[model samples]
Target: MKTPETLLLNQEQIKSLITMKEVVEIVDRTSKDLGVGKTINPTKVLLDLGETAAYPPYSGFMNAMPAYIGWEDSAGIKWAGGFLGERKALGFPYITAMILLIDPKLGFFRAAMDGAYITNMRTGAQTASALKYLVNKKKIKLGLYGAGMQGHTQTEAISVLFDIDELRVYDVNRQASEKFAQDMKDVVKGKIIIADKPEDAAQGDVIVCVTQSKDKFLKNEWIKPGTVVFPMGSYQECDDEFILSADKIIVDCIGQVLHRGALRGLVEEKKLSEKNITCTIGEMAAGLKEERIQKNERILCLPIGTGAMDVAVATAVYNKAVEKSIGVKFAFV
Candidate 1:
């Protein structure tokens, strides 16, 4: 009898297996599936280790996100962890994670791979999916509030979908924004400008805030009436007023958003409730709800990042890797 082997895909290998364009389509379809109840994405389980003597006043945490997509017959869980103090002291990334893909029928693990890149790309793809339904304009002036990994992918994903006439980026570290412009110069066919302030970056047709700041830096007055805003960060860059003032608020998952995403603070404070949400991106994608009906509607999209997206993209990547024979194979004894 032959021993079974499992596929192992590293970050670079997985990157070569998938493209941003394909990821957008996958995430878009996943949203529709979610709307139609074709997926199971449970709430992410989080474990927080409060400040210790070694890292006093700082904290570490880990989260387990699990999902199953019925249409694709894929199931997986992403396990990720991060420590703020370690990032600052060790000069390491704040988050690191991996995904384990399960054989839906056999009930065994089939593949394992790094999930950090997938997480960033899928998040951007989710934003693109929301933009497809919410933004009516064919061309847009893009405003970016952070120039980190998420910002880079957000710009890449959006530029893949729409023609960006102008891209204004702002970051506390000027070098970060400069690097972003340089890295994307060949990719984005538009004028890329560095903004001196967050407000300057917030001025555009479509604004995306991806900062990790705990305090709100985006002001409602800075946003134009017709602008579409995507606060994709972890409820860090937006305030209650900005959220409440939007004409239509769309979320990836209402349940997750209310407790973990941009709306978490508002929900906890009783300033906003699920009733205020216009609809889930899934609902809009599935045609169960209307998209931007009015030209002047200020639409805000808050996607907390879902586990179903991880499974969906991971499944696609795994299939592609198998077809291309891209991953390393190890026998399971």
Candidate 2:
């Protein structure tokens, strides 16, 4: 009998192993797997731990996301937690997570690695992948809301696919947006502007909101024709009018969106359903549905960030690690 061992990788190790472009490719393939029904992804189970007098003085939430990418023969689960207070007090990241990759055939754990990088990359990659079907232009004015970690990744990933002629960024903290512009100027080929208001940023050809704000900030009036919008957060960052009035609404997963996140409120209010969505990004990627049929159509892309992507990326990384003899491996049983 062969002894089993599981590879353990830290954030730095994993970062060295993969690139954002690689993650985008993995995410695009995972979407295709999802479209072809080769993926098993359960709705994320969230544990809302209200403000507790714990190590961090913040209302925190944790999510258990389990998924299987049958096409890749990969299975894994991501455990992620978010504590907003840590950012304000300790200057710590708001989100932290880990992923466990399992051997599907043998049902044995293969690797354990940091999930934060994967999480960030996949989130941005979702938008980039979806945009491949949504946008047809080469040069675009990109609008970004929330100038934080997500903002950076979203810009980085999108810059890989399209030439951002202009990047207008907005944040509640003006300094953060300024910092974002300064940091991303080299990445964005054209220009970086700090928007004075959310609406200013919303005027881009491609608009994305990655904020945690519960209150709606994006208005339908601010949106222009032929624009693709990505509301990447759980809450209602965009008003009901904007979500409902869009020419087409596409999501990563209809069930995941309805169960929780961006469009949940509309579902709960009996205003939206799976039928209302035009098609998933995956479906479009797989050629099962049409995307960007009209040049002037307004599109809304809700990518809730699926675990199948994590599984796919993690599995690929694990295989590479084994091939290159990277990371530490410990005996199992």
Candidate 3:
């Protein structure tokens, strides 16, 4: 008898197997499942490595995220790391990761694949799902802060879900903003404009912040009523006033949002509490909680990037790869 094999897929192979539309669909379904108590996603575990006194100022950390989707009987874990101020020296990405898929019934390892792409796309897809429920407008003016990898995917996912008349992008690096605008013009029909400041981008119909800044750049005054804001960059990009002023705040996970999500600072500052959050995006998607009831209401969504998304997307990708015979198979046991 032949030994069972595991599929190994690289970044390009994973990209070829998955699409933005498919990501949105799977993430949306996972969120709905979460609302109805049909999934198991544990709180992410982190190990913080403080910066050293090196010439390049090296700082490092690692994290492990695990999840199980009950509807699909799929499970997996994603192990990722970040090395700030050292990517150029190391000739690698600032962030890197891999996902390991498991057979839920047999508890056997089934596949392993690159996770960086999955992380970005799933984060964007989750935001896109939030928009479907939180933003009532069919046509919107999209604003993006930090036009990099995450920004590109967020724009891609949102464009697939909404009709954007215009896209305003802002980055600390003017060249990056120009490059982003030029790159995205072919993908989305909306006119892309480079903004001079983060405030300019915050005033759009749908505002997404994907920067790595530790300081708050988005102010309460910059956000207009009837706008849907996604603070996906954790608590780093949004000010306390901006978070407190929202009519409704929805999070991907209540446990994570309270501890590490966009509201973490507000929660620690004693300005906001758990009661302030209206509901999770899961609840809204499952019809357990109310959505945007008024056009003039300002709604905010903070998704901390759940492992359920990773597992779901990975499972889908693995199944597709198997069907298309796109990845290498190696003996596992």
Q: Which candidate is the best by TM-score?
A: 2
lDDT (10s digit) by residue, model 3, range 248-315: 88888888888775787778888888899889989988889878737788888888889999999999
- If ranked by lDDT, best first, what sequence of candidates would result? 2, 3, 1
Q: Count the backbone clashes (under 3 Å) in each candidate.
A: 0, 0, 0
Local lDDT at 189 for model 3: 83
The residue-by-residue lDDT of candidate 1 on 22-141, one tens digit each, is 999999989999999999889888666542224345566667999999779899999875667756588876667899898877767888999998999998998888888877787888
Instruction: In model 3, state the lDDT of residue 280.
Output: 90
Candidate 3 is scored at a TM of: 0.94
lDDT value, candidate 1, whole model = 0.84
RMSD of 1: 2.3
Give all candidate RMSDs, comma-separated.
2.3, 2.2, 2.3
**C-alpha positional error of residue 89 in candidate 2 after TM-score superposition, expressed in Å:** 1.9
Write model 2 residue lDDT over 139-204, tens digit each, in one string.
Answer: 888999999999999999998798999988999999999888888989899989888877888877
Instruction: Look at candidate 3 and give me any clashing residue pairs.
Output: none
Model 3 off-target regions past 4 Å?
1-3, 51-57, 88-91
